[model samples]
Target: MPATFLHRFVLSIGFLSLFHSAYSAAQHRSYLRLNELDFTHLPLDIIIQALISLFVIMYGVMNVAGDFKEIKASAELENKSWETFRNIPSFYTFSHRGKFLAFPHQTGNKKHN
Candidate 1:
């Protein structure tokens, strides 16, 4: 779905609220430092404001992104040609453990009986 005016408005409000909360926390910390007070927990109201703003931002973003399409493997490969599945020579590997069974005597390691 296209991003409506309401969505943009909500997103803007959320961002503003989040910024305000962050600024308020910073100011609170500064105030405590100026008075030489111990650093303690943030006020409940600021925490609540931040959480609510985060939820609002999430809601606004989901609405603005539009609906997701269903993905199907069969549908994806439907138009592909058979020639695309053919083996490529550059990808071939001739070096493997099978060579040991085929030419054990040729190997330098002697068997201990």
Candidate 2:
């Protein structure tokens, strides 16, 4: 049921069929048609092409996966910052003075004095 297992099985079957047709000969077939080749008898060119294609496809997928991971982590950090800010009422004020924070009394309410 796994994708990898299915892929392997399909490749095996394809290779077997390719070679089977190449070397096996039918009873009524001529010399050219009777010839049957084995699955492992594939030409080097085909193997090289397969390898090149696999490399390119795998590389592209891995690159995309890495980028997705980075974006997901950044989103998580942003959400956490937002959550803390929501729970802390005094977290929003920012000033260039000696104190970067302000207390409730700093609101200039005379009742607190």
Candidate 3:
């Protein structure tokens, strides 16, 4: 699914709604504090607005992010060539015990028996 103007618009709207609800909650708390009242819970309307906005944001994100590919190996390697799987130089190590075995006398680490 290609991301269209509508998707971006909806995402922006959702973020705006969420921020507005947060501001409203903060203002409500300040008002209660000024009146020496205990902070209980947020108003129903603010909570509802926040929940709706979350859903809207999720919907917008899902539509904007295109489809996901399959995780199967067959699907991943279907169009790949053998050259892609060839020896990668980054993984090759030149300094190892194998080199000493290939040239024992040159290494000057001979064992006396």
Candidate 4:
């Protein structure tokens, strides 16, 4: 089953507390006995490094998603600009009698009769 945010958070806290308690309890035991048991050992430096790496990776992923969204929006705007340009008549096209006309190319194809 997929774990939700709350589930993951609870699990993380629970595991950390459990390990803390176990390590604290082990300190009162004999040094030789503590060394014999491996479960109570907790290397905090590696855990901190892993957490930082995970945060950085997640941040990078979010940045990439935002970049793709911006690119999509720009492409849509460019398409609309092209459509508008195609629908507007150019003043450079004049009639046979030298009168300037401003009619879209699509509408100019229809006969008056």
Candidate 5:
């Protein structure tokens, strides 16, 4: 993912190809020449394999993106649920008549109905 790593990878591939070409040239190998190869005669399985690989990569990227979306949605729902719970008053703090107490005192400190 880092630019420097990508640059190194590209350079490595280029160097490897250059070395291979030089080695093949020095060997006088006529069969290893690229100019004599047919460009339009690829096998069916090669094309199928390439297509399947592309689909798999796309599926993986989309799967990760979908997971991020689901996580964000779940976090938002949790926040909203907590907010709703906090906005509602609990029974311990509820007001009755003109006073706010959990219950009347047993020592006759409060007037009973």
Candidate 6:
């Protein structure tokens, strides 16, 4: 579906706000608030860089959490701790104490083979 002209204009405004808002504040590395990590330093570039790095780290963590462990453990447990995301099993499996989803096809027994 195509968006209306109003929607496009709104999106443009939102993107423009980033540069405008950053430019308005002569003080660099300044944020409305600071967290434990942002202590002491108040430079705009530093703060922005830190925020970007944090976002990348968080994104990587979320991506890693999505899959890997489930498929590996499918051979040993009845229910894999790593879940199937959109039908794609995990790429790796972790070692747990008898807690996992076992694959019936590989293991004749309902429990870990």
Error of 4 at 15 (Å): 23
Q: Candidate 5 on 1-113: residue-level lDDT in tens?
A: 22354444544554455455455444434443545754444355544544554555454444433444455657566757656765755545444565544575577467669
lDDT of 3 at 10: 96
Q: What is the C-alpha local distance difference test score of each model?
A: 0.89, 0.50, 0.90, 0.54, 0.50, 0.50
TM of each candidate vs. truth:
0.63, 0.29, 0.68, 0.27, 0.28, 0.24
For candidate 6, what is the total of clashing residue pairs?
Answer: 14
**Tens-digit lDDT track of model 6 for 1-113:** 34455545544554454445456443433344443244364567645744554555454444444544446654555555545444554655466655556543554546656
> What TM-score quantifies how close candidate 4 is to the native fold?
0.27
Better of 5 and 6 by TM-score: 5
TM-score ranking, best first: 3, 1, 2, 5, 4, 6
- Model 1 misplaced regions, further than 4 Å: 69-113
Query: Candidate 1 has what TM-score?
Result: 0.63
User: Candidates 2 and 4: which is better by lDDT?
Assistant: 4
lDDT of 5 at 78: 70
Per-model C-alpha RMSD? 9.5, 16.8, 6.0, 17.6, 17.9, 17.8
Candidate 3 regions exceeding 4 Å error are 71-74, 87-113
* Error in Å for residue 2 of model 2: 31
Model 1 Cα shift for residue 67 (angstroms) = 2.1
The reply for model 5, stretches above 4 Å from the true place, is 1-35, 67-113
Q: Between which residue pairs do clashes occur in model 4?
A: none
Residue 14's lDDT within candidate 3 is 93
> Candidate 2 regions off by >4 Å?
1-34, 62-66, 70-113
